[model samples]
Target: MTTGPSGSVLVLTNPDDVTTDLVLRILAERRVPVVRLDPGTDLHAGAALTAAYGTGGQRGTLRTASRELDLTLVRSVWTRRPSPFDGPPELDGQERRFAASQALWGVGGILASLSGAHYVNHPWNNRAAEYKPAQLATARHSGLSVPDTLITNDPRQAREFAALHAGAVVYKPLWNTPYAVDGRAQQVWVREVRPHEITAAVAACPHLFQATVEKAFDVRLTAVGNRLSAARIDSPDLDWRQRQSLMECTPIAVPDPVARAVCAYLTAFRLTFGAFDFAVTPAGDWYFLECNPNGQWAWQPGPITESIAHAIADQLQKGPEL
Candidate 1:
């Protein structure tokens, strides 16, 4: 498929994502060619794909429905979550697994090979930012205040750290794995832990223990291509995520140093966009918690949504600074 111009935004997402929908609407208003795709499902359904790379050049095409997207014309590729791969039904269990893996690496590699197309948050960068310990350490080094943290596999060390923090420590999951209890999806939230609460169960897997930040409120800062939108969130629960219904979100100015730190943290991770979670104290100090390289920002109220949409569109049009 030959595209008209070398200027198009290829969205790697689904129709269900309102965030991507909002951006697509904005791009449409600005009269930009957009090729939205759901790679996982489409790759197996009927979407035809052609990817190639050699000394000659690298290029590909992803065609779905009646439209075709020339991979070479893509200026930006939004790497949002799409439906999981469910291959052809005729394949047996092992065959299905093998096909799925091959397709993931084959087609997925092609998408990743779009070096000219700017990724909002590159896949490799996203994988690197998943390490919470590394994130905290980097944030600290970049002049951001971070809570005292401990990652341990030994039960004895966990208790000692809790003691060192005067039992003001909280336990959080090292990985936010989707879990279900009683047929209901469950999310692990940060909660205060007592020394006695630390037990042999912690030895089963690596657990993160940290000194709980004295929270006057929580801040969710979404940064897109040098633009930072900060929202002050006030909640009544120890874990604000658990009491989102009781939370209030409002736009606020990010402190100068904190803003610099946020930009530095993004630069450190080599990400064009990031959602930073910070704990604000009564003393007016900010403590960095973590940075989700490809975090969600659609639900953020006020001007944040429109501001981010424009930022994303402008970034795509301007191309990568790197």
Candidate 2:
């Protein structure tokens, strides 16, 4: 691929990210300049950055193993999941911590300072949108239906919430963090929780409990700019992710109200891309579950995946609307 005279699309994601690979291929076909960098592992290894600031604003050059990107010439940036910054192995203890911190604020700050470049979903916005409480409140305010929910560390409140829902409550982790038991990695999948399960141990941290919606199926609605792709997922398990082999996905049209509400939610978060999950009841009501600001969409059925990739590529090629 060759750089175009216009500007480059700077992608910050690890090499193993297949989702990004799809978009990169489309960008290549369009002959748009592309600069892919994974700051975490690439910094000292094969990537270097030099930025300067003056009355004209920030300007710099980022040199990776295969490309040199002019910061001022960046049209847009895709803040995909990049690995955490790592210092050289030779440094340990406070030295390692110091080096990592410097790199984060230095290199990370420079990339974020690109003057005219638009971020698909800015890192700051992504971080803010990750809060479940904020999500529920924003979803409700945006005119989307949300389930009765509670976020608390008090066991009594948890028990009361579960009781009010007639033991039809589901427990969800606030954040999906990596865990392992006896050397085996495990995920805390969503599951039905009875009042008895609410113990004093819950006081250790805040837990999210919600009235389970009697759903006929689930929807994974992916939004890229103004484009939306809705995929209906059918699965027997409470968490569809637990049974990928048994799950089925098909394209579905978005209801007019749902579409408007989703757009409102995206605008509320100032995001250009989102992966929203919704539970549709037997009565055909769509209940907002949560939205992943930088969630995965490539795993959807072929057509949906292809459409998302094309939409993202189009946005990157066009940059942001002035």
Candidate 3:
């Protein structure tokens, strides 16, 4: 890709994203040139995207209905939850499948590989960080304590593992993507499990089983580049995300070791931003649960929202910190 003007930040997201809106607000105040693109919709619609290879990398331009973005001029990119590619309703099923693949790879690949662009948790890095097993292994490699986890497809072994953990095991999804069941949206929340709950259905697919962490409160640490801001969350439920209204969050100081470990994890996965979850025991132990490279932050219960917005805007404006 070719390098050109600076201070041009490209936001890749779906519509009605509050986090992106917050960053755009801050950017507007700073007079930064920004462009928003949703490839899932635009590429299949009237928009145009073109990329070409020269000597070094790729140079491209993406033109939406209202604006044209010079791919090489983008100094930073913030990718949020972009919707999946869905072809025109008239297309056949196989045709739609092919269109989805081309859109995902052809256009999406170039966007992911923008030259000289700083991504707040790049798409490739986000994909890797989303894997539960990869997160656990990376956390462990970073010297952080992770709860013992088992991804098994055996019903008897799952029961045995649950019994080994004194029945304090929690059932978690390896990937937390939501799907519709009977035309109703469904998501599997993390909940404590018993031996009897592991039935023959466990043989059909792999399930994530982990030893539960008995904790006083949860901590959500948002790391944007080198700036680490932590929020101590107290909730009555096993998963605070499900019981968000019943939770309280306060900005708190993170321990030095854990802070360093978080930074290392981001480096390990090549991410510029991360929302980390930790279970803090009463004894002051921080147990690493998972780190979402592109996790939510606008719904923070404390004043961390503005801080995060500022951090993201700064990161995108100034390019990533070395």
Q: Highest lDDT among the candidates is held by which one?
A: 2
lDDT values, one for every candidate: 0.83, 0.91, 0.86
| Candidate numbers, best lDDT first, in rank order | 2, 3, 1
TM-scores, each model vs. reference: 0.94, 0.96, 0.93
Instruction: Quote the lDDT for 311 in model 1.
Output: 83
How does candidate 2 score on lDDT? 0.91
Instruction: Indicate the residue-level lDDT of 2 in model 1.
Output: 20
On TM-score, the candidate that comes out on top is 2
Question: For model 2, how does the per-residue alpha-carbon lDDT over 227-253 read when each residue is reduced to its tens digit?
Answer: 999999999999999989999999999
- The TM-score measured for candidate 3 stands at 0.93
Residue-level error in angstroms, candidate 3, position 97:
1.8
Give the 10-residue window scoring lowest on summed lDDT in candidate 1: 1-10
Candidate 3 steric clashes: 1
Q: Which residue pairs in model 2 clash with each other?
A: none
Q: Per-residue alpha-carbon lDDT of model 1 for 1-322, expressed as tens digits? A: 1222356777787668877877778778777787888887776668889987789887788888878888887888788776656556678898988887877787677887786788876777888988998899999988999988999999999999998988869999988899999999998998899899888998898999999888899999999867899999998988878978889999999999998988888889888888999999999999998888888888889488789877877766555444
